[model samples]
Target: MDTTQTGLPVRRGPRPRATTTNPHVQLDQNAPAELQDRLRDHALSLPGVRRGVSTVSVPGTVAFFLDTPTERPAVPDILGGEWGHIHPHTDGSLHLHVPSTLADDLIAAGWAEYHSLVSRGILPPIVIMLYGPRDEAELAVCSSIVEEAYLAAGGSRVDRAGRTLGLPTP
Candidate 1:
């Protein structure tokens, strides 16, 4: 055993563990429906995307689940090549988790277009989650868009297979 000058044991092994949880995993309730519409349009415009679904929880939180006809897209350089695997659920839904910050950037850039769609009442509430930095500001902006859509749609929520969109039940 190694003893320090202060009579404390100095045993070295693996480093202390760090928590992997992210405290910033929150959404803003003020996102306009137009933003979500734009996100859906952008996703659909992608080469492989087949369909998109947006879910809005009360008090404002959006989650988007995009259904792509092909496998997950190759890692983009902007995301430091952080790869995401394609997860195929039993219900025929495919999930691809990418950097959240990247998702936010994409939404912010196309927000105006999305807002236009919302004005038409053709979009639904949904949050987009990707793989990257946890940018609270971006998420908040996106969330506001989703929140607006949900409210505009008469506050109606949808149920997908076993998943509920907008305000989970107690």
Candidate 2:
């Protein structure tokens, strides 16, 4: 294993594909442009949020940073992930960490469902997903739900400097 200066092992091998079962199925990318733009802008606008490489079952995937600027964000225990993220998929669905109540609410409302990874425990149970919205109204609601994930991760402008400086924030 290749170790970093911090002595943490770096992941270097055949990368795992975020998508497989649906590899043959293509999601509508031409649509949801507006929703994607909104998510990108909102996530980037955060004080310390930075876009990371893809880690999900879609194209144009990006992770939202939280808690530790140098390390990836972990889902708050309340959200059921020891460490997790806000993963937005190109298909307009999000593989993000969220609380059970929120997940249940969305699922009951038919707004979201669990990602396959969540089932195998490869991802936290909170990694709920919502398929691409069919209209602007649904898109708007989806955007807000993603924002809730960021908040649950303790992502906030006030905590930016603290995380970046290696000081406790949450």
Candidate 3:
């Protein structure tokens, strides 16, 4: 006797391909043309740097993606006392958002640092994105970077899951 449910055969194998289009699969609508140009220019100013993907919008913030070879230095002086906020999205990607005011200084300092690093024969390329409110979002992103560096200097208190994971008080 054939074992079937609802008069359909049970086939065990790879799932079939999806034929319908997902309405959400569209270009990033947040990014604007002028903002794109600014992000590109700023990122290019860094030494030994290469361009990365960026998107900007009026309500959203600017973002950069640097393709560096080595890990970024832990400069406490540069970062005030707060590492940038880090979030693990549902897609498994980590998103770090630094404040705008600090973001500007960080990028400037980053360029100087990058040049110094290159002089020492180190190639550290970074991707940077700027995002913020329509009026002053760029500044906000830069500020955030600085804030993050500051936080790093102080030390991170949270865990990978965004939960508090620190030593017990003695």
Candidate 4:
């Protein structure tokens, strides 16, 4: 397994190819249905997150957004509500707005690539598509990545175990 400079291990095998990142779909190496379900469940389970149909993504994509206002939402305007969403296609990939530095790291680590809109200057580079987890280990890594997105949203600080340390007192 190839690990990133930050120690996030990239999944084994060829990097999944993208047929069109604008619609944000993958061409091959899609995760199986079970893994896809598990990944989506894990992402939706993050603190302050809620699931709904994506207003920003392609039709049928399930969206994850902060249900409550964050103390300091970093990218609060993502499609007016969503901060991330899971694609409905077979690849099961997801697009999310994370911290810019982390986004660069994720791309460098081969875990993700910038959204097509970023290239055209329509969206900031913070938007990325984290490839779907291919197995158990990748699932864990992807979960961690989602947690980072949660943090970037100013949801709350959390431990590596995903426990809320407590929200800041207003």
lDDT (10s digit) by residue, model 3, range 35-138:
44443343333333333332321213223333331334343222221122211111111123333333344334321112122224432222122221122343
What is the number of backbone collisions in each predicted candidate, taken in the order shown?
A: 22, 3, 42, 0
lDDT of 4: 0.76
**lDDT tens digits, residue span 4-122, model 4:** 65666656766789855468677677777778888788777766778898987678788888767555876656676688888875668888888888788788778888887888888
- The global C-alpha lDDT for each of the candidates, from Candidate 1 onward, is 0.28, 0.50, 0.28, 0.76
Q: For model 1, how big is the CA root-mean-square deviation?
A: 20.4
Q: How accurate is candidate 2 locally (lDDT)?
A: 0.50
lDDT of 2 by residue, 101-151 (tens): 666666655555676656766656676765444456655555556655666
Return whichever of 2 and 3 wins on lDDT. 2
List model 1 lDDT by residue over 1-170, tens digit each.
34334332222232222112222121222223444345434333333223322222222222333232133332222212211111111111111222333333334443311212233443321223221111344343333333332322232233223332321122
Alpha carbon lDDT of residue 119, candidate 2? 70
Measured over all alpha carbons after superposition, the RMSD of each candidate to the real structure, in angstroms, is 20.4, 14.1, 19.0, 4.5
What lDDT score goes with residue 147 in model 4? 69
Ranked by lDDT, the better of candidates 1 and 4 is 4
* Alpha-carbon runs more than 4 Å astray in model 4: 159-170
Candidate 2 lDDT trough over 10 residues, lowest sum: 161-170
Candidate 1, which ten residues in sequence have the lowest lDDT sum?
Answer: 85-94
Return the clash pairs for model 4, or none.
Answer: none
- Worst ten in a row by lDDT for model 4: 161-170
